[model samples]
Target chain A: MTEPGRQGTPLIQLRGVERVYGQGDARVVALGGIDLDVWPGEFVALMGPSGSGKSTTMNILGCLDTPTRGSYRLGDLEVTELDGDGRALLRRYTLGFVFQGFHLLPRVTAQENVELPLVYQGVPTHERRLRARESLAQVGLSGREHHVPSELSGGQQQRVAIARAIVSQPKVLLADEPTGNLDSARSHEIMALLTRFNRERHLTIVMVTHEPDIAAYARRVVHFRDGHIERIEESS
Target chain B: MLGNALREAIRSLGRNALRSFLTVLGIVIGVGAVIAMVTLGRGATQAVSDQISSLGSNIVFLRPARGFGPGQSIIPFKVEDAQALAREVPGVVWSTPVSLRTLTVVAGNQSWSTTVVGAGEGYLEARRWEIVRGRGFLPSELRAGVAVCIIGQTVARELFGADDPIGQRMRVDKFSCEIIGLLDAKGQSAMGNDQDDIALIPLRTFQRRISGSTDVDSIQLSLADGVDNERVLQDIRLVLRERRHLSANMEDNFRLVDSKEIERTLTSTTRMLTTLLGAVAGISLLVGGIGIMNIMLVSVTERTREIGIRLAIGARAADVMLQFLVEAVVLSFLGGTIGIILALTFSFVAAQKLAFPFSPDYGIVVIAALFSGAIGIVFGFFPARRAARLDPIEALRHE
Candidate 1:
């Protein structure tokens, strides 16, 4: 479920990024002196054991959180120094996010969930409806547009979350354990969709998963241990 | 954005409708009680004013102050003193010597204990009461102490039911008196006394037949239009002083009370009660606000994951805050609206049953609604702020 589009310059850049959890005796380091770059048209998988800082690195990349110390850039924007609202606006226009839990609003219809980002953009009702319908169709959930999350199966719900993430044509897509909650069959289905989005739309993707099979779908995999990346390998 | 927020807020409430309605109940009761009490309070105040003014547009009551209160002996007034005031006092339109006694009276099949009033000529006019049927007493009938009486509507109803009492004869304590007229109904006074349960007779008839003495006490008088009640009361004081042979410097032995004074006292008393009732009801409104805050906090806690999702999807913190705040305001606003409608219906029906005045008071309705909305904002802030300030990562990870 993707579209053919152009590839541009490096979309995400991080240098010496460090994330600390607390202070003094309670202090814990999540990410330490990390340097990485994700350019347009690249599909990267992040893998790690528990508390290895892969999730923290994904959060900073997604702009859901900022590193304690880092020079972080999303395209031309200096995100590490940006305030909360600035990061929000950057996320609004430049980023799309998918969670393992498939965080489609439970009380809202699938179509409405897809229209959320545009709703924030103050899109007109007719445009929002049309675009949301198109996105739902893109995810092969056309007839299920009006169904609430609880009314759909797990795979169907994850598809709806994908529709929501990509509806706005964001510059980068961020997925944290997008297939973690699904069975093997559904997990491959979701991974195939992400791969299609990557190859066809050149949508830069940074995904975190513990599953080696899930990481295999990406062109490149970065493995982490403790608080730092152990290696970066290309699948060839 | 505002429209979206409002729609989302409404949708949020709709998701838990039973809980939302229960949450709003406190505010509804609070606002309803306040408006109802205020309307009834002012209604009672207005009713009392109307009754007092109906007594006479500009009327005063003169009575022996000595006998009316504690430790005081009876000081009687002759009918001649009423006549003297009518003839000599400035601003006096008419004066009537009044005698009131509670006694038993019987008709063919019914008997009742009621007040029998003895009043001289111009009595009804002086008291600003009306006769619905038959003629008032003639001067000759008043002077001669005829055995003729005027019945009030309640008295006639009790004695004769639907039968016209005019020209009928009823037995007084020891004698028969012919009913010459029926006074119109005056409903209940502010103090809840029935005003239509009396029978009126000539002053001389009461002094001789009922009291067995020529002694007259209370005097009721109406002043000419635009006359100062104080001036007339003072003039009557001088006339009574000279007639009773009191010394120049001594205080007159009579009491002078005006209808306006009664109205002022009634209204002031009612105003105080209205404030107190509103304050008491207002406190419950505060409780209602607290209820909103409690539910809002619960909602924020419950929807932590939703908030995180929204924030991660690029919803501003202010957007999250506004969403919660809008929900609270909508809750209280709905409660306030229901309360206003309830107050209107209740007060209208109650005023009719209680025979009190009714004013819808649109201004107060609006003010009360706004206050309820304000309460929502004030109480909802804490919970909304907590929701907005939540760390997105922690919230998304919350189980």
Candidate 2:
């Protein structure tokens, strides 16, 4: 598992993690005994087809779901043992998320949408505004802060979603099909933006996508099939 | 967190202003009706008690009971009966016999119909009535059955126009009588009767010239302070029964009504009416609450993706719950405020139209306000819980 550029402990670690839904007779395994590690500053993409458990793994990584069994650790904290509220607190302070749908509140301005994470983090209004503006500027949406999601184009809206994700300065950013709704050019722009954030801020990111071209942006790619990791590959 | 939630709630409600307003209309009507009913009811009770008090405290009305059976006949009391009761009953300070007849009186070709009350000495004192202008009847005038009368404000205004009524000659059915005094205006009785539309004459003059009989219609008795009214009433019943020669098996033909009893009855009746009206109005408030619940549930379902985004973005279940709860509460509270203002305006106008005092019951107002808030919490809880408990992934997947 050791590579030349990798050093120190993994920021996220999963050991024999499994997620099962329903009970006997109706039981289904979404993730079956998965094991993975993501080091700090790493940009890893998870690739798989439909029902291949890639989304489930991303959900677990984002602290939006819990493993039915086995230990999942984010930094030093054991995430699998945490309750809903405790997981929520971890997400609030240590993680951010970007969805496939660019789920900005339809009526809220871009500025307010970007401030949502910090609002949950209990940041004061003035600091929240400043941080939100800075985050929006980082995503190349500098003057579009007052526009509602419906008023913005799809690319602009996705940028606002990106700004919202990173406004809290979380330790990790989880993107589930982040550019699935965009055209090819827009998709490349969004990937380039993610790459820049990863390189400049040393922000760790875990992304799930089916497109090989999108996966090409990640330094390492993990392929999944039938609720288990099929193989891991290095791009260079 | 609360401030953000409140701002969010207000913005969300503002997005659908017409729907929000329509949803709260039930609450508005409910609270408005309750407040107006309670206010008018309180005013009515106040007017009744005021009229009763003006009739003097510790007073009683004694009258011959009407015959109930076909062959039975009512035997009216004579003037001597009132004097006898005053002499025989302990705690009785004074008593006066009264006879009433609705008659037309004429002065300077101005003729108007009015009630003529034939009362003996001490009648005005027993009734707590005062002479606003001119003097009361002289002792000799009452004894000699002289043709003299005291006109009430309505009669004075009707018969003499703007001119002074005292010393004016007014013609009754058959004789001319000089106006001895003018009685102060008492606007209306609890029963809504015109109290100032009457003229007062000596009992003997009414008996000799008008009715041609010696029968007294009713007697007004004023009692001494701190006297046991029940004991005095029982003594009066005994005296009347003995004087009328009623057998032990026969029922007394006289009925006595205490002013305090009438006051209690009227006050309680009005209070009961207030409660009934308030309850009927409360049903509408309940309907309003249901409306809030229905709309909130729809909101939760319609905003499923929004809730998912909020949850996925690290908002706690409690935070989401509070957001929706605050929305519902704000809607109902706004309705409650509007209802209070509308009720006050309505009650003021209604009070003027009905000729009763306008009294707003603040205690009830506050209670209704808090109750509306409680309704929000109670009805909003289910929908809020549903929103809070939504699965983030599934909700995001929802359209």
Candidate 3:
């Protein structure tokens, strides 16, 4: 945890990003305008009240949703107006997402789940297996690689999900409530796992959470109120 | 990438084992029914045509017009009429003058009532019969009007069980005729008559002793191969008309029956029947394809969240669609393979039991398999598109 923002280039830059749903009367603005920048090798938490657009911000940051009126440059590439395939390519190479619900494929084992992203990226089987095993080990799920999600505890399932997220060696990890479904003890364990990966690999992590304790793991926490960033707090 | 798609599809399909099997079941029965029906139909047609062709494909039957239908009596045809047909008919190569009489033949302690057909040495050639044992009546014997006969298999078995009948003499009413030959067994005629329940004798002897008349009952003509049978029929008609002195535009006093025409008629009728059966079976295949489509749609809806997760993890929409399509194709292809094996076995056994040729046409099988696979692609396309077009955020939000 000694170094923060040490990598040369700013990884994610967003300016005047807005996402509006529907048209005319049905138009409910999900993200009014979001201006944010995340430097390389930084871990940031997005915290907000319900319906304050924390999820919307995560979706945009994860490249799952496109902004209505702004520029989003993800590592020197404009992503705001990019098509679905272009965003997919960016996600494949640069971004990883861990959902709040721990969306591990139900019938498949942890190792197979971890190998999914690499499979989509057309990685060879041997390399995919090696990298999946390595990622699972990094997430403290070494011996549970063959256990399916149904056979695992909530925390273990979430660990498998994290392994899947980072298996492709993505530069940016976007996690939405990684500990949302876990208890206090299990939540803390997951937070420690994420912290070790962030600190050791210098992996830039953008996580969304309402719990202040969960936000405490990040070096900086950005608070959101009504689709806009209210304030940013830093920890020593 | 294809391998990955296939692997993914396999996993998803394996998740719901019963549903996967049930979904493929429709295809299985459809392909199976089509194959079995076509195969069995062809077998039946082949058996029928074989039976009809056994009546002598190139032979024509010349009977007095009054001899054909019930209540029609005849003065009968003359031996000279058959001789004229043999000598002067354009396409005729041989002729057999037939005269039949129903009489009780006695041998040792056994007596049986059977129809005895009187014809020349050319009868075997005209009827395409073979002397499996002994020998047919010689020309000299036919000319001499010798009391000799060639017995049918049924007659031979009835009179001489477990014993040779070649040199045996059977009583033909007041005349005793030696069994000079035995005709091979022909199970049944196209008209369902047991062909082995009669006996054959030289025509000259039959007319002098049995019939007490010189009038031949019917004339059977064997025409040369490659000659137009209809033209030969017309030539015989003209000759018979002249001999019978029938007026122009009047119905002739004779009937010229072409065995090949009967065969063609029966074949067309059976071909039509098989085609109709094939069409009905094809409908089941179409219904099976519809079933696949319905199941695929349901599968896509059920797996919406999985699709969402894959999309979020950077899976292309095309990739997801391909996975589902490949899954459907695999299911249908596998169903087709199973159906083909089952149909072949079913047809083979059924053909044997029904006494017909068991010709399993692999062309139909190959086409059926490909058709089933193509059905998968066509039917799977819509559902795959639905899954691919799902909004990732909305899908993930779905419970």
Worst 10 residues of 1 chain A by lDDT: A1-10
Report the number of the highest-TM-score candidate: 2
True contacts kept of each: 0.71, 0.71, 0.64
DockQ for each numbered candidate = 0.76, 0.77, 0.76
Q: What's the ranking of the predictions by TM-score, best on top?
A: 2, 1, 3
Clashes of each: 0, 0, 0
Runs in model 2 deviating more than 4 A are A1-5, A22-27, B66-73, B246-250
- lDDT string for model 2 (A1-106, tens) is 3232577889999999898999999999989989999999899999999888899999999888888888898999999788899988888889989988999999
| Residue B304 in model 1: lDDT | 98
lDDT of 1 by residue, B1-399 (tens): 889989999988998999999998889999999999989998888888888876778788889866333565657888888999999998999898999998888999799989999988898988778888997898899989999999889899999999888899999899999999999888877567888989889989998898989888798888999877777778888898898767865666788887788788889999999999899999889899999999999999999999998898888899999989988999999988898889889999999998787986778999999998998899889999999998888989987
The prediction achieving the highest DockQ against the true structure is: 2
lDDT by residue (B11-41, candidate 3, tens digit) is 7678777887888887888888889988998
lDDT digits (tens) for residues B1-399 of candidate 2: 899888888889999999999999998999999999999999999989998887777789989985444666789999999999999999998799999899999999899999999989899998888999998988898899999999999999888889998888999887999998999988888777888999999999999998889998999999988999889999999999899888787877888998989999999999999999999999999999999999999999999999999888899899899999999998888888889899999999989998789999899899888888888889899999999999888888999
TM-score of 3: 0.93
Candidate 3: RMSD to truth: 2.7
What DockQ does candidate 1 have relative to the true complex?
0.76
Please give the lDDT score at residue A46 for candidate 1. Answer: 96
